[model samples]
Target: MDKDQQNRITYTVYCINAFAERYRLTAKQAFAYLDRFGGMAFLEDCYEAEHQLSIIDAVNDLTQVCRNQGGKL
Candidate 1:
């Protein structure tokens, strides 16, 4: 990959790790929530650009799904 692509990848990883840390989430929980929403790559999109509430929205959506499935969120 080019230098720009490498930098972008590194930045994305940093941003996602920051978000997970901010929420006090384990990497496992963070990935699970993303996977549950069929959005395992959701972080990459937001990391590439500025995001408003999409990540939170996704977590909320995943929460609802878990609740409906009789599982704890």
Candidate 2:
């Protein structure tokens, strides 16, 4: 993969781990949550918003989106 793709993958993994830890989810469950909510795009947006948004806030946003889509994390 190219560097950008690698970076995205790395960030996705980080987000997956974060979701898992913060929500007491398994890795598989975390991946499902991310995938269902918008996958890498969601993660990238969250990272980009880090300066203006806390990770907890980002996660809360994602959780709400997941719920709106009929999924829970």
* C-alpha RMSD for every candidate: 5.3, 3.0
Q: Candidate 1: worst 10 consecutive residues by lDDT?
A: 43-52
**C-alpha lDDT score of every prediction, in listed order:** 0.53, 0.68
Q: 8-38, model 1: which lDDT tens digit per residue?
A: 6665455445545656887676556546654
Q: List clashing residue pairs in candidate 1.
A: none
Give one clash count per candidate, in the order shown: 0, 0
Clash pairs of candidate 2? none
The best candidate by lDDT is 2
Off by over 4 Å in 1: 38-48, 51-73
Tell me how candidate 2 scores on lDDT.
Answer: 0.68
Top candidate when judged by TM-score against the true structure: 2
Per-residue lDDT tens digits for candidate 2, residues 1-73, read: 8987787667667667777888899989888777776754556766556425655666676677677766755
- Please give each candidate's TM-score: 0.44, 0.65
